[model samples]
Target chain A: DVKVTQSSRYLVKRTGEKVFLECVQDMDHENMFWYRQDPGLGLRLIYFSYDVKMKEKGDIPEGYSVSREKKERFSLILESASTNQTSMYLCASILGGRNTGELFFGEGSRLTVL
Target chain B: AQSVTQLDSHVSVSEGTPVLLRCNYSSSYSPSLFWYVQHPNKGLQLLLKYTSAATLVKGINGFEAEFKKSETSFHLTKPSAHMSDAAEYFCVVRFSGNTPLVFGKGTRLSVIA
Candidate 1:
């Protein structure tokens, strides 16, 4: 079975503090993504990495950045956390193949900014 | 560019009753559509996908969705609602190859006993 593991399931951070959410997939997938979930707004993509060292901004990339220095691992960075940034963060990975778009997701990390 | 819209924000049904969640999308070309379910505090799980193959697609946990190109709709349905089926459902789309998915403002399903 494919497993996507998130380093932190829950965390609390002070405003203006730097926050990091780490994700790792064991399936050797080539595509990784970061998304933030908010009520009534659904899950909005923050960033995605198709390959090591290559990243793309998604619909809601503001105040967030991502790092993919290695294959199997992706990290989401909140440079300066704020109260509005408090939400559940999800990480997902997909195998890059012809016509394959199924995303395997992690258990999600819930962050509270105070 | 591609976008998805879930018409209803919430739907309530009794256990053993039918379930329906409406979704529509806009894409410049033929799109790949998907339905995902997210339980409270859990990550999104793919329920089904429609990639221009069979218009009607069956998914896990007795769920299904029919893709209608004329209406640009891909609505999810189930024969009967289960208590375990209560969750947030998102309709997603990826316009072209290798593009990230665009998600709709999910529909929350509540199952009543």
Candidate 2:
């Protein structure tokens, strides 16, 4: 069984505060992704990393950045959290080099910005 | 260029009844379509995938979806609805090899007793 663990299940942050959501996958998957999920919007990709130090912007990348300094961990960082950024964040990974492979997801981290 | 659409925002069915969740995608020569279910407070799980194989694809928990090239549709179906089947269903499309999957606004399924 592949396990994708999220550092925080829930977090509360004030506007202008820096926020970080950490994700770690045990499968040594080559690709990791960060997605923001909201009602009716499904899941919009924020950023994806194919390898360490390599990142690509997704559909909704504004106000968000990601770090993948190591293969087992991926982190999503919000430089300055805002009310609009309050949503459930999901982290996922795939084994192969191709990004279109079936994703293994983590139990999402729900954020509340005040 | 590539996108998927879930027809219903919400669907309700009584236990033991039939279930149908409609999904369609934009035109693409040969696309990979997938159905994913997200249970409450849980991460999304892959229900089934259609990678230009057999038209009818069977998935876990008695779920199945059929791929129709003429209509460009990949709708999910189940013979009997279970209480545990209540969840949000997402239809995803991948235009080709490395392109990211495009997701539709999910359809929330509600099961009644």
Candidate 3:
């Protein structure tokens, strides 16, 4: 079974603090994604990395950045956390194949900004 | 560009009753459609997907969706609702060949005893 693990399941951070959310997949997938889910808005993509050291901005990428240093790990960085940034963060990975669209998602990290 | 729209924000059904969640999409190319379920405080789980192989797709947990090109809709359905089926359901569409999926607002399913 494929497993995607997030570093933290729940996190609380103060305003203006820098925060890091880590995600690691054991399946050796080549594509990793970061998304923030909000109530009534669904999951909006923040960043996606198709390969190591390669990244692309998604629809809502402001105030967020991502790092993919290795094949199995992807990290989401919040430069300066704010109250409005509080939301559930999700990480997903997909194998590099014809069906690169099917994603295996982590449990998710719920962040609360104060 | 691609987008998806879930017509209903919420749907309530009794156990053993049929379940239906409507979703519409817009894409320049033939798109791959997917239905995912997200339980409270959990990540999204893939329910089913349609990639033009078959119009009617069957997914896990007895759920299925039919892709209609005329209506540009992919609505999920099930014969009977289970208490475990109560969750937030999202309709997703991704254009072929490496494009990220676009998700609908999602429909919350509530199963009543």
**Tens digits of per-residue lDDT for model 3, B86-113:** 9999998876655577789999999999
Runs off by more than 4 Å, candidate 3? none
* Chain B TM-score in each of the candidates: 0.95, 0.98, 0.95
- Chain A TM-score of model 3 comes to 0.96
**Predictions' DockQ, in order:** 0.65, 0.57, 0.58
Docking band of candidate 3: medium
TM-score of chain A of each: 0.96, 0.95, 0.96
lDDT for A12 in candidate 3 is 97
**Local accuracy of candidate 1 as per-residue lDDT tens digits, B1-77:** 56789999999999999999999999446788899998886678899998778999999999999999889999999
Question: Model 2: number of clashes?
Answer: 0
- Model 2: per-residue Cα lDDT at residue A85: 98
